[model samples]
Each structure stands twice: as structure tokens, then as C-alpha cells.
Target: MAITLSERAADHVARFIEKRGKGVGIRLGVKTSGCSGMAYKLEFADEAAPEDIIFECRGVKVLVDPKSLPYMDGTELDFVREGLNEGFKFKNPNVKDECGCGESFNV
Candidate 1:
């Protein structure tokens, strides 16, 4: 039961945290939206909730709510740059299928 971050992702997140100057870490979760019924949500966490589970990867902290863990366990978050397009990508072993737009998935 854990989430991981690629080195590039950790570097990117660390830089963002440094620029913003006030964040405990990044939070990762799932929300009910998009065509596939679930979409990944990522945000900066100023602090962890009492019920949140934390993972340390690449020297960066990753926070997750207890409820979101089942859906995101063993997920690896990666930062990618492809020409003019770049963003965070999820390599989720639990994902059964994903929407054509690549914005959502179902497990």
C-alpha cells in the first residue's frame, strides 16, 4: 500500500514547493468525474489530515486520504515533457480502462 513518484516528478514538485514557499507536500487522490467515472486529483498540501497516509519518495512527501488509497495504491506518478505538451502521468496498476482523452480511468 504505497504510491511512488518518479525523480522528475519529485524534482518538479520540489521546485514548485520552493517557489510557493509554503507547502508540506503534494496530495494525490481520486474524484468522481470525467467519462470513465474517476479522475485523478493532485494538489499541494499545506499539512496532512489526521486520516491521511503519507509516502516518502524521491525525498518528497506524498499524501493520500484513507478513502483514496485503495484506488491509488501502487501508483507511480511521473512528470513528462513531450515537445510542447507536458504534465503529470499516472501509471496505475489497478486501472482497468481509461477514457480516450486520457483524463480518467475505471478499475
Candidate 2:
């Protein structure tokens, strides 16, 4: 199992980290909340945890905890701008369905 970031995502993350002044990478995980039973959690990591599984993509590091791997395997994060709204998008192959609001998903 693995997680990845698109070139656009990597560039966005790298720029944010540089501007923020400190970071080792970005953390990707799932939490048991939201209408679809699961929601994606993202944050900057100043340091990696002992159990984090790390992957490098386009010069940026993507970190994931073991428990989240099954649901997020083969997921690629991308940054996009549609008119004025912009954010990270998850292209997760394991997702079976997502909530109507697109804030959560369930396998």
C-alpha cells in the first residue's frame, strides 16, 4: 500500500512548508467522523512519528499511519483551482462512496 501526491500538490505543499518555516512533510490519515463514516485528515508534520509510513513524490514527503493505509492505498493528492475556489483533492481508488457534500467517504 502507498500514498502519493501529484506534482501540483507537491509544489503547493513544498511552498507552504517553505513559507511556514519548518516541516518534515505532510501527514495523511482518516478519522471516524462525518456523514460517510470516514473523513480525511491532513496536516503538516514537523517530525515523523515512529510508525509513519512515508512516501516521496515530486520532491515532497507524504506520511501516513499504518491504520489508514488500507483505506488510502493508491490515493493520489492533487491541488486544483476551479475559478476562485482551490484545495486538495483525493483520488482514492479504494473509496466506494462519498458523502453528498464530498467531505467524507466510506469503503
Candidate 3:
């Protein structure tokens, strides 16, 4: 029923929004693609649609469409670093399996 972001992810998103100079929040969704059939979609949203379900965490906002909510419920978005590589990671409780390349998942 809800999505949250890690502190690090919030900080990273806030910094990016600040640098970009204009953004309402990050939009999270899922689309049909990749081997597992559903791939995560992310983007900086300058405005929210009327149907979006918004979640606030660490002073940052995440917007999700109602249609995508069921697949992503109880997901926590996080930013992480590993040596020279760093990126956003998803800790999704509903994900029963993920593609080998980590690009897609299925509940």
C-alpha cells in the first residue's frame, strides 16, 4: 500500500532536483519489458497527475500511478555505492523473482 525511500536515496534525489532547478519529485512505475516481463521505470517529475498516489519520505516525494501500485507495494527505493559503481536499488517485498541481469521482476 506504500512506497518509501532510503535516506541516501532521498538525499541523492533532493540533490538532483536542486541541481536540475525544477522538479516536484521522482516518479516510480513499472512497464512491460525485459526478460522477467516487468521493468521498473523512474524519472524526475515536474508535476503530478491527478491520479498519482504520492508518498513522502525524508522530505522527498515519490509519485506512483494507481495501476502500478499493486506490483510495487511495500517497495523501498535505495541508493547504494559499491567501489566504482553506484545506483538505485529496489527492495521489494512482493518480488517473487527477478531476471538474472536485475533489470526486471515478477511478483
lDDT of each: 0.96, 0.95, 0.97
Lowest summed lDDT across 10 adjacent residues in model 2 is found at 1-10
Q: lDDT per residue, candidate 2, 1-107, as tens digits?
A: 77889999999999999999999999999999999999999999999999999999889989999999999999999999999999999999999999999999999
Model 2: residues with Cα > 4 Å off, grouped in runs: none
Q: Residue 6 lDDT in model 1? A: 96
lDDT of 3 by residue, 36-94 (tens): 98999999999999999999999999999999999999999999999999999999999
Give the distance in Å from residue 69's predicted Cα in candidate 3 to where it truly belongs: 0.5
Best by lDDT: 3
C-alpha TM-scores of all predictions: 0.97, 0.97, 0.98
Candidate 1: which pairs clash?
A: none
Q: Per-residue lDDT for 1-107 in model 1, tens only?
A: 99999999999999999999999899999999999999999999999999999999988999999999999999999999999999999999999999999999999
Say what the RMSD of model 2 is: 0.6
- Candidate 3's C-alpha lDDT? 0.97
